[model samples]
Target: MLVFWNARLVFLSVPKTGTTAIEGAFAPHADMVISHPPELKHAPLYRYNRFFRPMFERACKVEDMETLAVMREPISWLASWYRYRQRNFMQGHPNSTHNVSFDEFVNAYMRGDKPAFANVGSQAKFLEPRPNGTRINHLFRYEDQSRLLNFLQDRIKQKVSLERRNASPRTQLDLSPETLKKYQRKFSAEFDLYNSIS
Candidate 1:
């Protein structure tokens, strides 16, 4: 997460949403950058509200810090995770996807008892609105890089440049139509959230 205190902005890092590239580009200019401990680095909304928000509200006396987040299209996001877990370094691990087909991986994801490989958390849940009205003020589609970058540049008053970092190994992701339909039916919330981000 990148917090620009002067800009009254906090950029929440959603997993598999190209946050590494953004962090690389903006870390130098950010007032506070949390990049250690994966749990802390990729903090979701509830976590932010519970841990970080109080500090800002009480100590900084900043009650209106706007939050920013990027969300990828649902299936595309899953494909990224599937491919990411297939990386060579993940081989032999319980969460590795090296042996599973994209369809199998997704099937596991839909299971109530998901295997480690398909246990990636939901994007929708990560960005849910809080009861106190602290919600994402600037939500961008990861597929649209221009708008996200433009917003960052204008807000930070610095030219932006990005280089891909922590990209997963390349793999063709193909899901059977039946599996796709089942997934969509089971996880409509994911689609609903992504579609609502216009």
Candidate 2:
């Protein structure tokens, strides 16, 4: 996550949404950057509200720091996670997807108790609004990088250029229609949230 203190803006890093690339581009201007420890790097809206919000509110006496986050098309986001776990380094890891078919991967993800390989967290849950009405002030679709960059540039007053980083391996992830239907049904919240982000 990146916070531009003067701009009163926070960029919540949603995993697998090109956040590494975005951070590479925007970190220079951010007053505070939580880039270490994956949990903190990808802290969701609720975590931010629970932790960072209090820090800013009490220590900095800033109560109006607005947030921004990017959400990817749900299926594509899952595919990225699938491919990521298939990397060469994950060869013997329990969470590796090296031998799993994409259809099997999706089915595993739909399980009430997901298998290690398909346990990636949902973008919808990550960006859900807190009960106190704390929410991302600017949310953009990951597929639309230009709009996101433009907004950040205008707000942070910085020239931006995104370098390719943290890319997943190239893999064919053609889901069968039956599996696709089931996935769409089971994980509709993810699709709903992404579609709602216009």
Candidate 3:
């Protein structure tokens, strides 16, 4: 979701990155524009699908926009995503009927074969120049939510309270060393970008 004032606070909502919480905090204070779903879309800053450029440009043209996003360690993010999907299966989402295991999901993700999960772009999309040459004003890390909240509070001159609701269950399964290595390679770019920003 994108939040804007006369001054733009464009939040690039990345999936599983506390976006709903961010939206709740900012919605009362800013004009909220829903961009993409948490599972399928990353922040629409850079590396966004080419088709989204026109819409984004139109939105930014009307306001003084400052871009922001939240990110997490990719492995943990993906694992959380997998578990969330698994829970959805348990809850009887029609789409989750197949009910693939986490191990299977990780294999597909590592091979870049999970089409639904694979296409979400890297953090570089937010941190670097866009394909359309637009640049974000700031990028935040999910790992450092307090910092982002503080920054937003300072910018908007209003105290924002973040609340975590509908949190996914924490995994009890420990990642094997080999699996960790595989994920590190699979998400190397995002890992680097997340580290740099944090």
Off by over 4 Å in 2: none
Q: Give the poorly placed runs of model 3, Cα more than 4 Å off.
A: 35-43, 46-64, 88-101, 115-128
Would you estimate the TM-scores of all the predictions?
0.98, 0.98, 0.77
Candidate that would win on lDDT: 1
Misplaced by over 4 Å in model 1 are none
| Native-referenced Cα lDDT, model 1 | 0.94
lDDT of 1 by residue, 1-198 (tens): 999998889999999999999999999999999998999899999999989999999998989888999999999999999999999889999999997999999999999999999999999999999998878889999999999999999998999799999998889788999999999999999899889888
In angstroms, give how far residue 169 of model 2 lies from its true place: 1.2
Model 3 lDDT per residue over 91-115, tens place: 6553241356555566666664555
- C-alpha RMSD by candidate, in order: 0.7, 0.7, 3.8
Reference-based TM-score, model 3: 0.77
Per-residue lDDT, model 1, residue 8, is: 89
